[model samples]
Target: MNWIFLILGGLFEIGFTTCLGKAKEATGSTTYMWYGGFILCLFASMALLIKATQTLPLGTAYAVWTGIGAVGTVLIGILFFKEPADFWRVFFIFTLIASIVGLKAVSSH
Candidate 1:
């Protein structure tokens, strides 16, 4: 359903972000591939996000899509890219999740 699109959009957003990070670290042809993948995934994610907003409320769709994408990407960065895992990062991510849940509740009304 629409929720599926939202989730897929979020996943694709994460994919593009991760690819962007990889592209920054890559060189030569591999760099171009990563850059291309990042751009393609970002466009696809935005299109799917728009589709999701048609059924879901705007606030709900946007919050869920962006929140999940951000949190998921940060997690990936920490795990795969070896990004720092400090308390402040965890706190902000939790805050984002809370805001997403709050937005969903408000949008349901």
Candidate 2:
């Protein structure tokens, strides 16, 4: 389904972002490997997004994709990159989740 594709695309967006962060921390050949992961994830994410947009409304799909990417990247940051997970940060993430769900529920397509 297109929704599944869209979700996978969003997850790959997270993958690319995580790879970028990891690449920043890497050195020498390891940095190139992370960059390679970034390139692969970027390609997959864009491909799936293009496929999903064939049926899904562009606005909703884009929003949901970015929403997933944002929330996921933030969580990844908190868990792996030692980023802050303060109250407001978490509250906004929940809000973003609700918005993504609301978009899915309200979408007629």
Assess each prediction's global lDDT (C-alpha) against the native: 0.92, 0.98
Candidate 1: tens digits of C-alpha lDDT, residues 1-109: 8888898999999999999999999999999999999999999999999999988888779889999899999999999999899999999999998997787767753
Query: What lDDT score is found at residue 21 in candidate 1?
Result: 95
Q: Worst 10-residue stretch by lDDT in candidate 2?
A: 100-109
lDDT of 2 by residue, 1-109 (tens): 9999999999999999999999999999999999999999999999999999999999999999999999999999999999999999999999999999999999988
- Candidate 2 off by > 4 Å: none
Displacement of residue 66 (Cα, Å) in model 1 is: 1.1
User: Model 2: how far is 69 from its true place, Å?
Assistant: 0.4
Per-residue error at 48 for model 2, in Å?
0.3
Estimate the lDDT of model 1. 0.92
